[model samples]
Target: MTLPQALQYLGTAVFAVSAVLAAGRKGLDLLGVLVIALITATGGGTVRDLLLDRTPFWFTDTGYVVTILLSGCATVVLLRWRHPSERVLQIADALGLALFSISGARIAEAAGLPGLIVVVLATITGTFGGVLRDVMCNDIPLLLRPGTIYGTAVIAGATLYVLLQSVGVPRDTAAYAGMVVIAGLRLAAIARNISLPALTIRDTDAD
Candidate 1:
C-alpha cells in the first residue's frame, strides 16, 4: 500500500483500540465491544466517502475491515485479561486523531476539494467516528464536551495541511508534518488540561 493508505490503516487500528477500551469501560459484552469497535473504526471514513461521492474505503478494500475486526477482538481479549492505564488509551486516541485528520485532508485535496472544504471534511473524518462510538456507549460525545479540544485539534491539523500545501510542500511530507503538529497539540492539551474559553451567560433580570 501507499504511504498515505498505510497511515490510514494505522489510524484505523488505533481508533479501533480506543473503541474497544471505551466499550470495556462501559461494561459491554464481546459482541457490543465488536460493534462499537467497527463503528469507531470505519464510521468517520464512511461518512467522508459518502460526502465525497466515492465508494467507502472499507467496502472497496477488505483490509480496513479485517484490521479493525482483528484488532477489536484482540483488544477485548487483552482487556478482559488485564486492563491498561487510562493514560495509554488517551495517548493512542490523540495519535489516532492526528493521523486520521491529516489523512482525511490529504484525501480531500487529492480529490480536488477546496481548502476550506478539505479542512471541514478532515475534521469530520477525524471526529465523527468517535462521536458515534460515544453516543452508542451512552456517553456525551467528546467532540461536544467543553474541555476535550478534539475538534479543535483536528481543525488545527487540517489548517496546517492546507497552509503547507499552498506553500508547495510535497503532499506526503506536509501530511506527516500536519499529523505531528496535531498529535503534539493534543498531548500537550491533555497534559496541561488546556481548554477553550467557555461562554457564560447571566440573567440580569433575575430577582
Candidate 2:
C-alpha cells in the first residue's frame, strides 16, 4: 500500500482501539463498544467524503470495516488483561489524529482544492471522529474543550503540509513531516499539561 493508504488504515485502527478503551471506561457492553469504535474510526472520513462530494471511504473499502472490527475486538481482549489509563487513551488518540490529518490534507490536495480548504478538511478529518465519540460517551469533545490544543495541533499540521507542498517538497515527505508535527505537539501538550488560555466571559458592574 502507498504511504497515505497505510496511514489511513493505521489511523482507523488506532481510533477504533482508543474508542474501545474509552467504552470500557464507560462500562459499555461489547456491542456498544463496537458501535462507538466503528463511529470513531470512520466518522471523520465519512464527513470529509460527504463534503468533498465523494463516496464515503468505508463504504467503498470493506477493509476499513474489517480493520475497525479487528482492532476493537483486539482492544477488548487486551483490556480484559490490562486496563488502560486515560494517558494511554490520549496518546493513541494523538497518533490517530496525526495520521488522519495529513492523510486528509493529501486527499484534498489531490482533489485540487485550495490550501485553506485542504487545511479545514484535514482538521475536520482529524478531530470530528473524536468529537462524535466523546459526545456519545457524554464527555466534552476535546476539540470543544477550551484549554485543549487538540484542534490547533491538527490545523498546524495541515497548514504545514500545505506549505511544504507549496515549496515543492515531495508529497510523502511532507505528509510524514506533518504527522510528526501533529503527534509531537499533542504528546508534548499532554506530557507538559500545556493548554491554551481559556476564554472567559464576565459581567461588568453597571455604573
Candidate 3:
C-alpha cells in the first residue's frame, strides 16, 4: 500500500483506541464502545469529504470500516484484560493527529484549494474527532481547552507543508516532513506540558 494509505489506516486504528478508552471511562457497553470508536475514527474525515464534495473514504472503502471495527474490538478486549500505558495513548494521539492533518491538507491541495482553506481543513481533520469524542463523553473538547497546543501544532505543520511545496519541495517529501513536524510538536507539547497563553477579557464592573 502507499504511504498515505498506510498512514490513513494507522491513524484510524490509533484514534479508535483513544475512543475506546473514552467510552470505557464512561461505562459504556460493548456496542456503545464500538459506536464511539467508529465515529471518532472517521468523523473528521467524513466532514472533510462532505466539505470537499467527495464520498467519505469509509463509505467507498470497506477496509476503513473493518479496520475501525477490529481496532475498537481489540482495544476493548485488551484493555479489559490488562491495563495499557498512557504513553501508548499519547503516542497514538500524536501520530493520528499528524497523519490525519497532513492527509486532509493534501486532499485539499490536490483539489487546488486556497492555502487558508487547506490549513482549516487540516486542523479540522486533526481535531474534530477529539471534539466529537469529548462531546460524547460529556466533556469539553480538547480543541476548546484553555492553554493547549493541540490545534496549533496541526496548523503549524500544515502551514509548513504549504510553504515547503511552494518553495519547490516534492509533494510526498513535503507531506512527510509536515507529518513529522506535527508529531514532534505534539509529543513535545505533551512531554513538556507546553501550552499557549489563554485568552481573556478584562472583567468589567456592573452597576
Candidate 4:
C-alpha cells in the first residue's frame, strides 16, 4: 500500500481507540461505542472529501471500515477487562491528529492546492473528527475549547510540511517530520500542562 493509504488506515485505527476510551468513560454500550468509533475515525475525512468534491475515503475502500471495526472491537474487548486512563486516550488522539494532518496536507498538495488552503484543510482533517466525537459525547469540542493547543499543533505541522516541501525535502521525509512535530508538540503540551492563555473580554457598557 502507498504511504498515504497506510497512514489513513493507521490514523483511523488510532482514532477508533481514542473513541472507545472516550465512549467507555460515558458508559456507552457496545453499539454506541462502535458508532462513536466510526464517527471519530471518519468524520474529518468525510468533511474533507465533501469540500474537495471527492468521494469519501471510506466509501472508496473497504479497508477503512474493516480497520475501524477491528480496532474498535479489540479496544473494547481489552478495555472491558481494564479501563484506560484519560491520558492514554489523549495520546491516541494526538497520534491520530498527527497522522491525519500530515496525510491531509499531502493530499491537498497533490491536488495542486495553495499552501494556505492546504494548511486549513489539514487542520480540519486532523481535528474535525475529534470535534464530532466530542459533540456526540456532549463535551465541548477540543478545538473550540479555550487554552487548548490542539488546532495550533495541527496548523504548525501542516505549515511545516509545506515549508519542507518548498525547500525541496523528500516527500516521505517531510511527511514524517510533520507528524513528529505535531505529535511532539501535542504530547509535550499534555505532559507539561502547557496551554494557551485564555481569551478575556471586558464589558464596555458600564464605561
Predicted structure with the largest lDDT when compared to the true one? 3
Number of colliding residue pairs in each model: 0, 0, 0, 0
lDDT minimum window of 10 residues, candidate 3: 75-84
- Tell me the tens digit of each residue's lDDT in model 3 across 102-194: 999989988899999999999988888888888888999989897678998999999999999989999889999999999999899989999
- Taking every candidate in turn, the Cα RMSD to the unseen true structure, in Å, is 2.3, 2.5, 1.7, 2.3
Misplaced by over 4 Å in model 3 are: 205-207
What TM-score, to 2 decimals, does candidate 4 have? 0.90
Model 2: CA > 4 A from native: 1-3, 85-89, 203-207
Q: Which is superior by TM-score, 2 or 3?
A: 3
Q: Indicate the worst ten consecutive residues by lDDT in candidate 2.
A: 2-11
Q: What is the Cα-based lDDT of residue 45 in candidate 2? A: 86
Candidate 1 residue lDDT tens string, 1-207: 897678778888889998888888888888898899999989988899999998998987899989998999887778657887878878888888998777788789889989999999999889999999998888899998988678998898889889987999987788888888889889999999999987787878958
Give lDDT per model, in order.
0.87, 0.89, 0.89, 0.89
Instruction: Sort every candidate by TM-score, greatest first.
Output: 3, 1, 2, 4
lDDT (10s digit) by residue, model 4, range 86-135: 78778877888999988888878888899999999999899898899999
Candidate 2 local lDDT, residue 157: 87
- Candidate 3: give its CA RMSD in angstroms: 1.7
